[model samples]
Target: MAFQEETLNLQMKYFVLVKPSNSTPSCILSLSTIDNRDIYNNLCQTVHVYRSSPIHDSDSSFDIFHVLKEALSKALCYYYPLAGKLVESADDGKRRVHCNPNAENYGVPFLEATANCTLSSLHYLDNNDLEIAKYLVFDPQDKSYPLVFKVTKFLCGGFTIGMGVLHAVCDGFGASQFLKSIVELSRGRTEPSVIPVWERERLVGSITKQPFPKSPMNNVAFSPFLNETSSTVIKKYCFKVEGEMIRRLKMSLRKENENLGFTTFEALAGFVWRSRARALKLNNNGETMLSVLVGMRRNLKDFEPLPKGYYGNSCVDANLVLKVSELNERPLYEIVKLIKETKNVGSTSEYVKNSIDTWETNGKESLKMKSGGAVTVLTEWRHLGFLNENVEFGGNEVVNVVPAPCNLFASVDMSIFTSSNKFDDENDPSMKGGVNLFTSLPVDAMPRFKEEIESLRFLS
Candidate 1:
């Protein structure tokens, strides 16, 4: 199939306000302190692309919009909080959801659109043209609604389901649960497999309002917000690290410490961090940091596990700080060990509680990065289940899933995605295993970044 090199034109048809089929309670849902962080003050958008199957093409009377709208209504009946309004408290700046019973006031925005080109032309949304993203997702100017969706059909009969959800409402895991509810209903399921539990109070019950000291090592920093004033142009690039390469990297790391077994994330994130630091050519004496989200849902030494259906911002920040010289000079295995240790510490019950308390007390102002340090934020979406096989449209599973071009996370230094044969040609071995890495860097620095990562291909 010939792919189009230019951006495809999209026409927005109409928008519908979708509400829950069943009535829900009218109340205010309080957001956890973690959810009120400055970092999550924006929207998170993603697109799930589905190809035209024989069944969809053969049925002339089938309307994708109608099917989805019905499923959405069903989904909202269960996860009604998502269909509510995101409002702010007048007394304090904290955000909460006001679940108004009226449909006109609480409905989520749903849009219908059509694209001039086929999914193949856009390389299943793998193209570099960021312009294509504008039409794929609906971005509301105000935070009135907690969620917004757009369903764009391609000329070739393929369609993409795009969503924009307020990050403060839920983390990736929570969003995935809500998405699964819709998918299950769309597939004729009466209800979602896992019932959602609203337990924000459980996570934030213990509040110690005290200021915490800053990291003694000036080398460590939280990932910085985008530098709008910088003259350098940033470009996004996608690279694939084959499964064999990852195995080799992990094997090599294991040789350093036979007892220390490194998972794919530990080894890969460490490798990317080192590669980025080297590519940027930072001063050896300067500090470079790797920031990652550590999941806090598991059973800790002193804390019970969070309920299975409890989907909130149950994650803590974990940063691995190192001197540039040490990072570049140390063996890859040692760096992987450091990554593993950072995660271990960050996942502990005491550490998680302290981090939450510190964030709650310090407020958003204290969430700034140091003035003179390079930071890379790594988010693992491969295991997020955004592209689960069960999430199908018209009996066909989605072929590709991509974050909206406007996503703030996309502006970060690096993001990792699941590798799937479905994303590309099934015959292609490279897409079947390993992970896909999306990287953003200064235009001039990308080539060096690519070079640094490319060396991993021959690690074995």
Candidate 2:
């Protein structure tokens, strides 16, 4: 939690503006309504870790900074919007990318930094403490740029690449695609495997003309505390849920009722949601909500598919509302089935279009979550290609991929990641085929929360 005994003594070496290698059209790109959410106004940071390579010690010919900077420039040729900065419209006050044709004005910030200690001394950055981890990423007060990159080299030849991209520009999947492109270019590829597409207009379907009903998203508050200045302190904990436990849970559910198919996500999310409610000991009369961020790429393919390389904020949060007593009373299978059904209904083309139309008609305020009630938001990142793709820079082995910590809402938020190559060891049975869950909850309830999760798994 304290970063370590040895001080990082990290110092900034230099900051350079990396522009696109080839000229791209200069125009103001209007972000889709889905991308204009107020919650996505800030940067979403992710740090990519790489261990020491032979090139770091013996090969003077290979320079990490030089290779990555050049690759970034080439990647920018395809992802030019990232080189541009976000600007507000004069009329609607909505944010949009302003691509300055002048190469001098539009460029992504590439920062170089150095740490006095080795990455292993920092435990390969497996900790969830933001106070220590924030140093590795670049998060500035002015978040106008669509993208920013920072590479910090350690004394032992290891390094971490910190990427900060505006969430409105893309979702986790889209960002992963951009990262793959950079990795490809850095590895001496002339072109990326997937071409980039920028057609935000396609997300804007026909506006809804019918009278809108009360949406469940309105009741799904992300935080129980309304004021950020409250004295409540929330802490984050990362737990590895073994594949055996997940399989057993699913098997138990099937034994009860074999009619429905249970996914790992549905089973785990249901368990965590129920576990949190029980741990918190919420009043039975009160309501609890579960919101899951569902990727709409496959759903859109059913009706008017987006381009192959189309990467934007193509995700919608599906909400499930239930009374606190009902959540505790219902069996795990019922909860899992409910979650599956919610996802099934939300993943349709009609639902996506209707969501878009609602946002377009009523604006972001319509989707704004109200304060009060217990809410837990779950998002699955295993299949997002961050671990599956070749995101390696200059053949460096990726050690870890982590979301940089930020001050978010007071409610519980869970990010699930499957076993990565870093932990995929044939000898280490405990580390294989399992999912790592990153959970943030109030510091007071964390002990009980862990107990509840363990009890559920063991009882199942």
Candidate 3:
């Protein structure tokens, strides 16, 4: 009760500090929780997502602050862990993973630092400025997501919501749950048009139950051969990619061959693998490997869906191996076809088992090596976020989405998030979707990278 009072004071101070001015980036979200001592090590994952689409229909009316206030009030009513520092059995029956926050692998005692994931939507006179569409608050000054979201107000009146999500318990999906929950609370309608489910063990089972392997040799996640750079930089650029371009490449795949039979992701992922390989000059390279994350939820489709508001790493990796020259030499369609064949409907048990086998496998998996060819990874977080808009506040809705790339599992050299957005929403043409790209290279690489992107001839 006392902490609640303190939280209120913090909110008021923050609100006064971030008061809206014509130029200042305004505050759109603010809330706090008792800093759970066992948070960081206990947390399962941390991710920030953004969604934007042009507002098509008009109803230039909203009670943005009133809606957001109600939403936060409800989120505060339910105190939950951001990340579940877990300890459990390897076998099935929906058990927690055997983990120790203090253990070497897990690094026990999840941190309790308050975190935040801020989502601010800046308005433009025209849609030409898509590049600077959504500026997310990454690398928070608080060093956490929840802390950044201490105050909430809709900026530019009603078009966007800034969110600072805590990382200790939820991943992006969990954040969506909070959003949806708030939406329901604001409507004075407790019957969540869709309710959140939070049974962790049932969501993402133990690694022991479903293993995915991580090798040493080809994996770029941990290798000494990285270009001379800081560890922090390495972590960030671990996997830098262009989502819209990827979509374009994938759409090309579909247009080229109707029966090629592969998800756009599978097709273009191969192309990206080849592109990175070519860029890095690793063609015809020796044992080239890429691993893709597979969510066990669909694999276990026979079972009930994982609980809503579930925040755990619910997926594992699939090994994609190829000779770099062989991959590069083949037509894009052929490479994608191969990717399709490699697909497997894996489950938690399979993921846990494969991880054990792969960790024991002869080489490094997550490590990105100058010696190895390019690697391609996949994630369904973006795909799943399609429903985020279902959770809304007043007239505001989450329509488009972007996922932040963070150091995950200490294995992947390149972590890819499939940013999903629906462009046809006529009512909210105000939203435009684009990927929020993060890289591990020095800040200097950004200028050059931008130059390269600008220099690219899309027509050519």
Q: State the local distance difference test value for candidate 1.
A: 0.76
Model 1 shows how many backbone clashes? Answer: 0
Q: Model 3 misses residue 213 by how many Å?
A: 5.2
How does candidate 2 score on lDDT? 0.75
Number of the predicted model whose TM-score against the real structure is largest = 1
Error of 3 at 423 (Å): 7.7
For model 3, residues 1-460, the per-residue Cα lDDT tens digits are 0112211111222231121111212112111111111222221233222232234124344434444554554443442222112232234211222222232332111111111222332322112222222222223333322323322222223233445444434455556666666567677865444444444334322224323432433533222223445342322432223444545565667677777767646754675555555444453545566666666445353455655444444444566677766766777788787766656534445444454344333122323334322454555455555445556444445544433333342333444544434432333332234333332333333344344333322412
The predictions' CA RMSDs to the true structure, in order, are: 3.4, 3.1, 11.2
| Cα lDDT listed for each candidate | 0.76, 0.75, 0.40
Off by over 4 Å in 1: 1-7, 128-131, 205-211, 215-229, 370-373, 409-414
For each candidate in turn, the TM-score is: 0.91, 0.91, 0.57
Off by over 4 Å in 3: 1-69, 76-79, 83-155, 158-168, 191-195, 203-226, 229-259, 282-288, 299-311, 345-374, 386-389, 397-400, 404-460
Over 125-163, each residue of candidate 2 has an lDDT whose tens digit, in order, gives: 765454456678776555798888889889878889988
Better of 1 and 3 by TM-score: 1
Candidate 2 minimal-lDDT segment of 10 residues: 217-226
How many clashes does the backbone of model 2 have? 0
For model 2, the superposed segments whose C-alpha errors exceed 4 Å read: 1-6, 103-105, 128-131, 211-230, 299-302, 370-373, 408-414, 418-421, 424-427
